[model samples]
Target: MNRSSFIRRLSLVAAAGFASLFATSAALAQAAPPAAMRETMAIGDEPGRVSTEEVIIREGAFARQLVFFRSTEPVGTLVIHTSERFLYLVLGNNRALRYGIGVGREGFTWSGLVRVSRKAEWPDWTPPPEMIERQPYLPRFMAGGPGNPMGSRALYLGSTIYRIHGTNQPETIGHAVSSGCFRLANGDVIDLYSRVQTGTKVVIRHAATL
Candidate 1:
């Protein structure tokens, strides 16, 4: 073939190859999970970015950490301030396991001085009258199990209905969407439950200050 004729044929072949590769990639993308399913978990800042890297629990997941997000505070108490979305378990040398929590919404929010009066593994959940009334579609009570909204562990806060409990809805870990309950990820709650015992002081501070 002449030089110009050979060049034209080569260019045509390259274009066809590029088109085939693009087709394959589009098909693979379509076969993957739906866009809604892809967004089941929260993605901060960037939309598609997710941190699946496993958080290593050195001793236990509940074994406290040594850092405080809030600059002011002595470091040896369990302070839960819902409005701020922080749960600080002070480790004394100026730090705490600052787990992001989903606090109660609007009228459902509350504040009080309570203690961790009871602890349970995979605790049963009976929606309070207000909760049942608010979300009537939910079952009156859900048995303790893996799928239960109250996750792997629970620390009942005093004699009231509030609890630092594990949530099946792990994606809601750091938001304001509960009924006056302090909600955590299942892994974190189980860790917290194991270290603390009954009568551990649980001070629900003003959500604004903590």
Candidate 2:
């Protein structure tokens, strides 16, 4: 082969090698589990409607797991997985606070990165357009109070309308039953809201339960 042709063939071989390397890298990335939050609960039942008998009994089953929340130290990041109905608060030293939660409906879910931009005590309930459209009977907005859908505390997730907040409907803690927000039990939300501060990162990963 002429000098020019030999060089051209060498270039082609180099390009093919690079392509193979790129494909291998992509495959490895796919095989690795994402460094994202994982959920531990199933999606069933509705909020505010669980029977009282369950209140005492259910906690024992879930409570036996490793403790995830620590109050004595500074707050950490939080992640909520809608599909698994679980929330994870990342604590330093490889520890974390994990809690069961309720998520949105079939098509009423969202997942992305956000921060706890604001917090409230006994926050008001303002139904969003999508929420109202879903439940036409729901009021446009409900003032903050014990009876409001937003229970005792609300941790606003940055500029987005989403939130990881307390819910008046505790029965929905381990179910899929919200418009698109992450709903925690009143006690759990209160505990979390106090520990987390504004500007804490929150990642929502919605996927199948483990």
Candidate 3:
């Protein structure tokens, strides 16, 4: 073939190859797995952003950390020292994932062994009738999202109204603020949620000491 004819043929071949590759990519994208399209168990309720400002506590007891936890409890046990505002997950080696949390105020305190019966990500909030009676200004029900008081995830405790959940108020961490619930930062809750499954043991300390 002459020079110009040969160059034109090569250009045509290149264009056809590009078109084929594009089609294949589009097809693959369309056939993507449902899991891929579904939301991740990230800290934030916002799409494409896996974190929220409410989860950020730059320096405080509520900061997420791995600490030396001396306990005889089996691995995967969730231990909460309500007075200390600390929640610990027994890691089986004198270690635990310690997270700061907000405990319930005086009349709402409870201490006992409970199991995580259910878990939900970015869970909705519904104030119990008693809570509504106490705070008439509060919303009856709040949908789950960035604005939701339940920040990112919630672990329901033994079918009770109380839950271990994420909080919209970062300042509440390491304080007694909730009606009866234990509140963690969204980032910390997401981390905790990933480490525990439904039916996990939860021990809440209500005694004079941990």
- The candidate maximizing lDDT is 3
Model 2: per-residue Cα lDDT over 35-129, one tens digit each:
22222122211223322211211353223134544433334877665655678777756567677776644212456777788999878777666
Candidate 2 residue spans exceeding 4 A from truth:
1-75, 106-108, 130-138, 178-180, 208-210
lDDT of each: 0.55, 0.58, 0.66
Report how far residue 172 has shifted in candidate 3, in Å.
Answer: 0.9
Instruction: Give the count of colliding residue pairs in each prediction.
Output: 1, 2, 0
Q: Residues 76-128, candidate 3, lDDT per residue (tens digit)?
A: 99999865778999998899988988774421345788899999998987766
Better of 2 and 3 by lDDT: 3
Q: In model 1, where do residues sit more than 4 Å from their true spots? A: 1-65, 69-76, 106-108, 134-137, 178-180, 208-210
Pairs that collide in candidate 1 are: 67-95
**Judged by lDDT against the true structure, how good is candidate 2?**
0.58
TM for candidate 3 is 0.68
Tens digits of per-residue lDDT for model 1, 70-169: 5344444468865556678766555566666655442124576677888998888786665555456767777787766666778887777778876654
Q: Give the number of the best model, judged by TM-score.
A: 3
Native-to-model Cα distance after best TM-score fit, residue 67 in candidate 3, in Å: 1.4
Using TM-score, rank the candidates from best to worst: 3, 2, 1
